[model samples]
Target: MTIPEPGGPDALLWSEVPDPVPGPGEVVVDVRATAVNRADLLQRQGHYPPPPGAPAYPGLECSGMIGAIGPGVAGWEVGQEVCALLAGGGYAERVAVPAGQLLPVPAGVDLVDAAALPEVACTVWSNVVRLARLAEGETLLVHGGGSGIGTFAVQLGVALGATVVVTARAAKHERLRELGAAHTIDYREQDFLEEVRRVTDGRGADVVLDIMGASYLSRNVAALAADGRLVVIGMQGGRKGELDLGELLAKRGTLAATALRSRPTGQKAEIVRGVQEQVWPLVEAGRVRPVVDRRLPITEAAQAHRLVESSDHLGKVLLTLG
Candidate 1:
């Protein structure tokens, strides 16, 4: 298997390493496409090392056909089209994933496009549905509206009958509005808190999906309504800050922080099961679709690294094997 190295993108060499075989309860995929994510960037930077026993290759999720199943694997076949949440090894042409982590690609969507699904949808659904308990007819705020997770959040929040407010660049406002952002605040030109307050009639949002961590922390709390839940999925801005615990407690807000890549296999499998039951139907019915920013070859991972590092991509970016 030839895969990108962990440490700088410059160290991403295509070396022919040993191929992987599934252990009991595992399955291997013939990868068709893999999506680049912020975690992939951190892994390449050496700040985020794969967990002990996790594969060293960078990919966290992928879309592919099942090549083989290991002992004890069931309810799946050799020729299934699967979009998998991998425990690494996604950058390689062949990746071994736990059987329970594999989700069947929706019938009408292309497999390569399905590569864009697992991480973003799982992130949005897990944080919004599982953690925050977002309810219908409430207001939800999503930071980074043009991102893969944001796109999914907008659609999912809307499909569940929540009014959505998204922070985006002005260039993305129209697109976000079309995707069900009832209010779009261009972060470059306006304050998200003010716009959200105005849009929600000064009641604040019922839920907030935040990628900007400490930088948005106080402001996010300020933007939450009574008993609002704030789920923090990433700290793209900065990590440390002093919070007004008094204000948070007064508002009765709850904050939850989580990461998908570092989760225990059982926990991830449970998330996969929930999404399969609740979210996959939306995909099959075309109410939700993977938003692909672009696709490139896996061998050109050097270029792929540049694309993600630039932070200019609007949605999920994919890399395919030859």
Candidate 2:
């Protein structure tokens, strides 16, 4: 992760940097695995920079065993297997993270697979369930149904009693349907807006989770029903575009964007706490678990980035400490 400033996949290299040690209110984890995110790729490409006071390393989430605790850190013990949200430093042999951001690995899943949960789950919870306020019996439209966030959104939306329609390419439709997407739109072959209209009986969607930013702005506003909400997380296509201001006002719609990696430590810890209270028990009881597509050694980071960037994998591609 220290290969070069604004590094690319080819630039991602393993270096023998000094192992992390805990600072006050922090704990150092002996990392078992770390998950790849688009943000990491951006950072490597010199497009994204870690927020102020964040670690210089490049990983947003990781699972590992506890190694040491610093002063004032309590309620966690050495050797505990956990997954944590990090501002950075996840792509290392040992990562020092704030104790409050850590969550215990669920009863049945391996520590490695658990690495996939924290980031996506936190994102979904903050957006779909929290900001958008999706309710049972509502219609939820999810763009990018094949992605880690999309898959999680599909299952969680359906399980919450909302009708879920997803936009994915044809090849991934069947699996997406199996994962609780009530309707699927092959975005390559069909128009997402047209499909959402058809699936919602022309009422449009009650909630739309969009990862395509400006590209979908005007169309997303058009696809929403009265009092609907549109949550934008990533703009894969482009960042600037026109919005249908008339449509937004006419439909009484809501628009919001959030990023997890760049949040303040207190805010991030609060999200973690909320997840533990509301989502962790469900995971513990087998209601849902992190979905993993593949795991590779940290030295093979470049290959993992290629897999994720290819958009072929269904869930998450993780990098383990070599």
Candidate 3:
């Protein structure tokens, strides 16, 4: 897919593009599937662009078979089934991926569905587990529980022995609970901060994985437990908001914001390695699995984007190729 001009979902033009050649330490993947992400939507709207040296197209993760390998890349051979975390270029039939970012498909996942795992696994494991250090017995509050990141975070938190609480639409509450959410607050009808307090008996969440940035900033701070950590990964609600440092100080809370696509290749590789080592095992063991709402052909990416933008899907909406 190529975007001649950035605009709405229709801006994605699935036209011919030159084949990608693998550079040193990279491999070319004949993409089988790719997953739609909020970042893709942002890029489509011209609000976010790929980092330097990345493909102009938008896709953050893909699953496929290795079609070629570049010099200085070893331990991976052509024709191996794998998935990758991409900075961009996953919207096409093929993509060149840094060797370090490739991961073998988890033992039980379908090749197409495997595309759903890389981005969400890396994001949640990196921020929620590695950075925030959400320990066993802690309470984790996940905003946007029906999203790819939200669904993955909910499951990962549960797998790590935390009590997971999520704020999502009432329609998604049942599914979120089935995915291991201990409490589900309907964001449209309930005040999450109040609900968090009620559910935790006023202790609040020990860790919060937030996506609604500025709009939720104050309430997120107020919902934090003493010594809490809040990791903000998206700005769907807005980017500028006032933070009550006094309230954060009184709670002894910590706040961190991160973006995955802009990270250096080496850092991304490390996160990929972390996911393979820690999260892949959980997946193979069936403790954690990819949650896909539906799959659409690559050519219908505009429809997929419409579905995601509408917030009607429960999990990831995948784009597939032959």
lDDT of 1 at 110: 97
Ranking by lDDT: 3, 1, 2
In candidate 3, the residue pairs with backbone N, CA or C atoms under 3 Å apart (3 or more residues apart, or in different chains) clash, namely none
Best by lDDT: 3
Q: Write the per-residue lDDT of candidate 1 for residues 189-283, one digit (tens) a residue.
A: 89999998898889999999999898999999999999999988889988886789999999999988898888889999999999999999998
TM-score of 1: 0.97
On TM-score, the leading prediction is: 3
Which wins on TM-score, candidate 1 or candidate 3? 3
Worst 10 residues of 3 by lDDT: 1-10
TM-score of each: 0.97, 0.97, 0.99
Off by over 4 Å in 3: none
Model 2 misplaced stretches (Cα beyond 4 Å): none
List all candidate RMSDs to the true structure: 1.5, 1.2, 0.6
Which stretch of 10 consecutive residues in model 2 shows the poorest summed lDDT?
1-10
Model 3, residue 106: what's the lDDT?
96
